[model samples]
Target: MYSPRFIHCLVSITASIVAGTFLQSTTINSEGSFTNARQSQAQKVQVLSVEFPQQQVPIVRFPRDVYPEIKFSEITQPQIQVQANKHLTIITIPTSLLFECGKHHIAEKAEKALNQVSQAINNRYSGSWLQILGHTDSKGSSKDNLQLSEQRAVAVQQWLSKQHHLNVSMVTTQGYGETQPIVSNTRFDCFERAIARQKNRRIEIVIQKLDHQV
Candidate 1:
């Protein structure tokens, strides 16, 4: 038969072994959880770092050229075309609207459109350089067309100076006779040819900034 004291001691030893095993298991699990938490924190930091970059991109811009403004509403002429760019502004008027056929004189009926042009120059672009370019269609001999174009340009310059009292020194004139046609004049139909020729006959007022010498 076993002694009571020996059995009590054996029971105490078994209890101690079980308690040791449970403590060891708890310690290992706690360490694993702490490691996992640290790993998750590192992953969050990495994701944030990727989403926001450290360096920033730079923006670039070009400088605008100084130029004068033209009010389009002030020009009531339907046939006039006003075009502007970074460096120059061009006002194109059909010669047929300004003068009679084969004539270099400005018609009295065309005073309204000319008045608007003069007003624009006097208002905003008086200090700018003005170039009056005259063009003719393929109607007459090249020599005659060239002379007519020059005369027309000169007449416009004179009218602007004498009538409007603008500075004549700022204005210059040129003629391109049947050479710089805006449309093709080789159409087989007479009406189409006439239309093309009419479109080709025009006077262009080119306005440039003071920095550019005409």
Candidate 2:
């Protein structure tokens, strides 16, 4: 018994009401989600801001007297016999220092003296040269005495070269057996001539061609 126009009008009104209700509900839900998200971000920021104090490090100190120490071994000096002149210095090694009874080998006790002599020669006469002369007594045969004297001189030269590290070219050696005796040969009843001749047996070290400017 209802009319067609009225039925259509009622259906249109019902659809409008349902659409408005759905739109309102969607808007409320979106607003609530946005508010909840903003609150959670604010709480996270507060938790990151905590009260923490800075701790200072202490400075360490050392003793004022502390210093680097240096240590060295003590070096004992050798005894030096220096005879310096206006031109040159003559370093003499006694026969007893270089040899025994008619012997040619150098004594171990004389090493210090030889080293001292070599050092003196090296330091004092840098421009000069050394001459080593060997002397002997007249008791033995001329040939044998001459050979012995030569051997003695060579022994001295070897010591200088080996122990003192001296240049062989800077030194020259010669032997004058009984021929260049310092004391004259005399026959006396008191053995004075023998004693004097014994003194003649020796080695003479002479520095020559010195640089006078030194």
Candidate 3:
């Protein structure tokens, strides 16, 4: 039979071994967690240290040349196409937009466009001659259409002169009546024919800028 003292000593030794194993396991777990945390922090630092290149995109613009100054040429916007050829700048305005359909009177909304063009011309191009030519669709009699076209052109000329402070002598007016057909109006569809007719009715402003000789 084992002595009581001997059994007590064996039990104490087993308890010590269990405690030591538990402490060793806890220390290993703590060190593993600390290493993982350090690795995570280092990865963040590495990511932040990397550099990226920045790029700048260029903006390009293409506009028909009217005047040398960009501010002055802005009046020749997309709606009013400006074409330059041999000392002349041709600015076109849709007569349908300027005037009501089948009428000689100018539309109220046309004031905005006229104001822009007038200001540009007045401020930039001094002593330049402006010629306004009115065109019409094939609808009415030649005489009546000619008279109507002339009246429409005259109305625009007067508006530019009086409202925009342009010189009356600097502007001249002409009418083409139904003689100049920009687009053919012989479409079977009503909508298509109307579209073609609208194209025919246009107001062309020709600006002649003479050379400056010192």
If scored against the real structure, what TM-score would every candidate get?
Answer: 0.64, 0.56, 0.61
Report the C-alpha lDDT of model 3 over 1-214, residue by residue, as the tens digit. Answer: 2235423432342122211111111112122344576744443222223334444222111134423322345474556656554455567778866887778877898887888878777775677777787878888787887788899889889999889778878778878787666578675488989888877777877666656510
Best by TM-score: 1
lDDT of 1 by residue, 36-87 (tens): 7675444322121223234321211111232233447668778887766455
Where does candidate 3 stray beyond 4 Å?
Answer: 1-73, 212-214
- Residue pairs that clash (backbone atoms under 3 angstroms), model 1: none
lDDT of 2 by residue, 22-60 (tens): 121111222233467675444422232333444322211
Q: Considering every candidate listed, which one attains the maximal lDDT? A: 1
User: How do all the candidates rank in terms of TM-score, highest first?
Assistant: 1, 3, 2
Give Cα-based local distance difference scores for all models: 0.70, 0.58, 0.65
Q: After superposition, how far is residue 135 of candidate 3 from its true place, in Å?
A: 0.6
Instruction: Output the worst ten-in-a-row residue range by lDDT, candidate 2.
Output: 59-68
Name the candidate, 2 or 3, with the larger TM-score value.
3
RMSD of each: 34.3, 47.7, 34.5
